[model samples]
Target: MNAEIIGIGSELLLGQIVNTDAQFISEQLSTLGIDVFWHTVVGDNRKRIMEALRLAADRSDIIITTGGLGPTMDDLSKETMAEFLGMELEIHEPSLNRIQSYFTTMGREMTDNNKKQALFPKEAIVLKNDNGTAPGAIIEKNDRIHIILPGPPSELQPMFVNEVKPYLAGKTVDEIYSRVLRIFGVGESSVEAKIKDLLQKQSNPTIAPLAGAGEVKMRITAKAASRQEAEKMIVPVQKDIESRLGNAVYGYDDDPMEMIVIKSLREKEMYLALAESCTGGHVTDLITNIPGASDVLLESCVTYSNEAKVKRLGVSEDTLKKYGAVSSQTAYEMAEGIRKISGADIGAAITGIAGPGGATRQKPVGLIYLSLSSYGGTETKELHLSGNRLRIKEAAALHLLNWLRLSLE
Candidate 1:
């Protein structure tokens, strides 16, 4: 079935808040074999919302609206939708009881205006909101379905998954599954060049490539009667692609490179330390951000200054004085130093000229050196990434971690 997501908030159109609900809804719908053709975001105005609703209803089988479900004057989603559908708004007794019980449990006074949350379109299916006071609802008219959810993601997400999903699941046919292979150290153009034939001939299972700062993600989606069938369909293609470019594909299906590196290190009984310069410790930040990383991550040295490199990671003054900080020699020494000092099984370093400044004629900005030091291996590679300071920093981090993933394997 075709669906449309309509996010009702001025903040979305004004770019104050991103419309994450549409993204969540689109992912969920794809799993249920529903194609979302349009994503509409309308302000908290009655006329505009009504126009959006009317447009969505005319073309889409299922219309999902998120936001503006609050107890305020600007919260006009339910009231406007009721008016548009020529339906009356009535207070749901169970919802009213839930709200009252909640306020009483907190020992707080329930104002009259709070009762507005209990109002729903007449004869609508009440969507219980366990996380918030604003309960959502589902209504069907003229063979078209309307699902209105609370504005807060905490409320809308759970209500959609637990209460609303089952209702919608029964009405759909077939199942769809998608797997994404995230590749680093490879340009999107090169990846496309290698897989252009497969992409061009795509039919039941669609292949799409998405390019970002310094990496490309290839998504393969298939439709089948069950998820197992879809996964089975993907296995052969996944194997073929892996065989061709196993060195570049770091992780699969929403797995970040840092997570893969961490997990691989755990499997190998290895610990890691980082000496970051261009990435400004973002590599350490990503690794430490994961839960239980303390078990494997010993220490991280952000030696942005030449003095810090010399003192913290034990880089020799002569090496820095000769080859400079952004050189591969400095990166190698930094990795070896951090590994020895921290007693970690592995040390990774990223030293680069990530800049709007500080680049020579031979070494331009975005020139990065990633080094890995391990018992059986010592490797260093250079990368030239593009973008502003933040992008260069982020890309440099991802590149170093992905290279660590390769070394671990």
Candidate 2:
């Protein structure tokens, strides 16, 4: 079924609040094989809201609305919905008692205006609000379904999960499922070029590629009667994409580079150490963010200067003088030094010039050098990145983690 989301709020238009409800609802609806066609954002004005509702009813089979459900004078969702659908607003006695009891337990006065929250369209299904005072409603009228939810995400998310999901599940036959494949080291254009054929001839399972900071995400969505069947349909397509992309595909859904590195280390019973320069403690911070990292992360040293590199990671002054700090030789020395000092199974180092300031005639900005030292051998890579200081640092950290993940695999 096709759906449309109408957000009723002035705060959203003014940029005072973000409408995360539409995104959440769209994702949830897609899983039930429902397609979200349009997202409409209207102010608290009644005329615009009514217009949006009328347009949505004509085009969409289902209309979901958020916001404007409260005790305040600005709240107008229920009144508009009841008028448009030609339903009488009746007091839901159970919801009224719940609101009254809530005020009684809190030792607060229950004003007459608070009773407004308990009113719903006659014959409409009441959606209980466990988290707040405003309850939601679901009304099916004249071949269209209208669901009204509160603005607060805390209330809307739970009410949808507990009440709306099951109601919608009964109305649909097929289910939609999606898997995300995370890639690094390759630009978005390159990855898209490799999968252009899949995108052109797509039907059942669709491929969508999104690019972000130093990484790309490929979302593979399929529809079937069951989750297992949907996933089975996605298997061959995913395999073909992976085969074309090769090692550039680092991780999967919700698995960033750091998590992949930590999982590999823990699974292989290995320990790792870090020596960072231009990235400061960013690499170390990313690694330690994952749980159970302490067992595998032995030590992390930030050797910013020549003295610190010599004192902490044992980089010789001669190498720094000959090839400078951001060099392959220095990177290799730093990696080997950290591994020897911490006695870890693996040692990774990142030394770069990520900046708007630090640049000589030979070494320009965004020149990065990364190295990894393990039992097998030591490998080094150089990167000439572009962007602000923070972006360059983020890229360097991602590169270091990707290298570690590739080596472990």
Candidate 3:
């Protein structure tokens, strides 16, 4: 069934608060095979809310609203909805009792205005709020269903999960399942080009490509009676995409590049050390953020200055003078030196000129060199990236981590 979410609060339009409720409800509805066609945000004004309700009723089978269920004078969702639906607002005694009990348990006095929260449309299914005073409701008129939920996430989330999900599940016949494939070292356009044929011939499952800061993601979605059947339908498509993309596709879903690298290191029983320049220990920070990182990471040194490079990482002063700090030779020496000094199985180094300054005629800003030193051999890569200093640093760190991930494979 097609649904529309109406976020009723002036704070959303004024940018005072983010409408995270829409995102949460959309995701939950997707699992029930309900397509969210639109999201409408209106202020607490009764006229605007009534207009939004009229529009939602015309185009959507189910209308879910959040916010404006409170004791304040401006709370208007229930009143506006009742007026539009030609229904009478009546006191739900059970809900009133719950609200009174909540205030009593908290050792607070119940005001008369708080009773406004217990009012609902006649013949509406009252949804109990365990966390707050505002009780929600489900009103069915004609063929359209209107679900009113509280604004606070703490109250809305539980009410939806405990009350609304079961109600919607009974009406749905199919489930929508999605899987995300994470890709690095490839742009969004290139990924789309590789999967052009799959996109053209897609039927049951759909393929969508989304680009992030330094990575691309392909989401595969399928609809079936059961999740197992959906998985069966998605396997061949996933195999095709993986075969085409090869190793550029690093991990899946929520696996970050550093997590993948740490996992690979743990599996191979290898320890690593890092020597960072313009990245300023960002790569090391990413690695340490993951749990169990101590098992794989031996040491990390931020050798920013030429003196530190030479003294801490054992990078040769002669190499720095001859090839410059951002050169491949300096990167190689730094990696070899760190591996030797820390006694790690592998050492990775990043040297870059990620700045609005420090550019020569030949070496411009965003020029980066990455090197890896291992027992087998030493490997280095040069990248010419373009962006602000922060973007350049992030992209350079991601590239170095991806290189390490591929080497471990």
Candidate 4:
């Protein structure tokens, strides 16, 4: 079934709050095999809400709305929906009792206007809100279903999970499942070119490529009678894409580079040390952000200057003098030095000129050298990237992490 999510609040339009409810609802609906075609955000104004409802009802089989179910005067969602659907609003006695009991249990006085939370359309099915005072409703008219949910995620999420999901599950026959393949070291264009044929002839399982910060995400979605069946359909397509992309496809679904790297390090029972230059401690920071980092990360040093590199990471002064700090020789020395000093199983280093400045006659900005040292040997890579300083730094960090992940594998 096709669905449209309408976020009803002036705060969303005013940028006071993000419309995360729409994202959550869309994800939930997608798993139920409901296609979310549109997301409409309307202010608390009645006319605009009515117009949005009209548009959604015309094109969508299911319309889900969030927000404006509160005690204040501006809370107009229920009243507007009732008026638009030409239904009479009546107090649901059980809901009214529950709201009163909630206030009483909290040692707060219940005002008369708070009773407004219990008001629902006569023909509607009331949804219990255990987390908040605003009770939601589901209205069915002329083959269209309107689901009204609270604005607060804490209240809305539980209500939907407990009350709405089963209701929708009974109506849907097919289930949709998706997997996101994360790729690094390859540009979005290259990824698209590699998968162009699959995209052109896509049908049952659709492939969508989304470019992220310093990475690309390929989301493959499939629909079947069950989630397992849907995932089974995606496996061959995913393998085809992976075979074409090769090692550039790093991880799957919600796996970030750092998480995968740390997990790999832990699995191999290897400890790592890092020596960072132009990226400062960003690579280290990313590694430490993952849980259980201490199990695998021994230490990290931010050797920003030539003096620091020589003093801290034991880089040879003669090498720095001959090839400069951003060279492959210095990177290899730094990686080996850190590994030896920390007694780690592996060492990684990144030296680069990530800049709006610091470009010389021979060396340009975004010139990066990455090195990894292990018992196997030491390896180095040269990269010429382009972007602002922050982007270059982030991209450099991502590249190093991907290298570490591949090495571990």
TM-score of each: 0.95, 0.89, 0.87, 0.88
* C-alpha lDDT values of all predictions: 0.89, 0.93, 0.94, 0.95
Per-residue accuracy of model 1 over 58-82 as CA lDDT, tens digit each: 8999999999888888999999988
Q: In candidate 4, residue 39 scores what lDDT?
A: 98
- The root-mean-square deviation over C-alpha atoms between each candidate and the true structure, in angstroms, is 1.8, 2.7, 3.1, 3.0
Over 183-276, each residue of candidate 3 has an lDDT whose tens digit, in order, gives: 9998999999998999999988999998999999999999999878988888899999999999999998788999999999999999999999
Superior by TM-score: candidate 2 or candidate 3: 2
* TM match of model 3 to true structure: 0.87
The predicted structure with the larger lDDT, 1 or 2, is: 2
- Best-first order by lDDT: 4, 3, 2, 1
Query: What pairs collide in candidate 3?
Result: none
RMSD of 2: 2.7
C-alpha lDDT of candidate 1 relative to the true structure: 0.89
Residue range 277-394, candidate 2, lDDT tens digits? 9999999999999988998999999999999999999899999999999899999999999999999999999998998998987888999999999988888999999999999999
The TM-score between candidate 2 and the true structure equals 0.89
RMSD value for candidate 3: 3.1
